[model samples]
Target: MMPVDANVKKIIAQPLTAEAFQKYGQVVSVPRGDDGQSANNNTAKRFNFLGNVQNLRSDAKANMCVFRCQPVAMPFHMRMLEKHQYSNQMFSPMNAQRYLVIVSLGGDEPDLQTLAAFVADGTQAINYNAGCWHHPMIALDTTIDFTCFVHENGTKDDCTVTQTKEQFFVHI
Candidate 1:
């Protein structure tokens, strides 16, 4: 692996807010009463129309899965990023905990310089728009189980990964 540049890109993690994260995806959270509403006989608070689950291809299918992810400490180097061309990916924590969300924007092939990191508290979840580049799950503090919604067809085309020749470490 190539060593990181002398001046590696350092992204400071920011609080995950819907406005800040809008370009990349939707921030899934229980909206305030003024912004959202109660559904299912007031048993649940709904934040509707979060993100589009785009599966343009014929073979694509939407499915749900639970991901148990280990914690990733801070100051970790990131070398690769991935994108799902056929669908949007959503992750909501089953347990209350904070986690890291890293993303870049530039269509199918993202520019490393555009990378940004955000810290999402347990109350928040995120949905990555189709073809958006993002790092894999990074749970912080403790192990976490996330309910994930994604489109897949059991093929390599489901995802595309780009590896950096140099490493980039995230800092909070």
Candidate 2:
């Protein structure tokens, strides 16, 4: 165990699950056999409607990008959170091992009391609902290349960031 900061909130990351993460976003993965259909002459499987991209603004354009992220040094300190008020965001790991997903629900600012941390394995992807507050992806173990999706119109509303008065520390 490590010493704690007087003003830091310690959070233990739980395993990411669809039911537990519904409020903030959807968990995407290969569906169960009955939930998907065979495609390409049974050479592949297709899972339909796992999640929807919320592009609320008329001017917003969907964008897909690849981010090569560096691993975060532990114990991780979370100082701020960000959100897209007009669009949802998605991240799929191309070559990640494990990562952290931290989120909170509130009106304009994040509700620290509702703060939740989840540890996601390589196969899991997450899609955040519009206006959902979330910390940036924190890659663990090694550097990762993640395919990210979002809607943008080159406006400030594309993303809003808020710094927390009390930072949170994650220990996995």
Index of the highest-lDDT prediction: 2
Clashes of 1: 0
**lDDT for position 55 in model 1:** 78
- Stretches off by above 4 angstroms in model 2 are 1-3, 33-35
Candidate 1 per-residue lDDT over residues 76-130, each given as its tens digit: 6788999988789999999989999999887657877678899999999999998
Our model 2 lands, by Cα RMSD against the true structure, at 1.8
For model 1 the local lDDT of residue 141 reads 93
Error of 1 at 141 (Å): 0.3
Off by over 4 Å in 1: 1-7, 33-35
What global local distance difference test value does model 1 have?
Answer: 0.86
Model 2: per-residue lDDT, tens digit, 1-172? 3467687789999999999999999999986565578899999878888987898999989999988889998778888999999999999999858999999998789888989999999999999999999998889889988899999999898999999878888878
Report each candidate's C-alpha RMSD, comma-separated, in the order given.
2.3, 1.8
- The TM-score of predicted model 2 comes to 0.94
Best by TM-score: 2
Instruction: Assess every candidate by TM-score.
Output: 0.90, 0.94
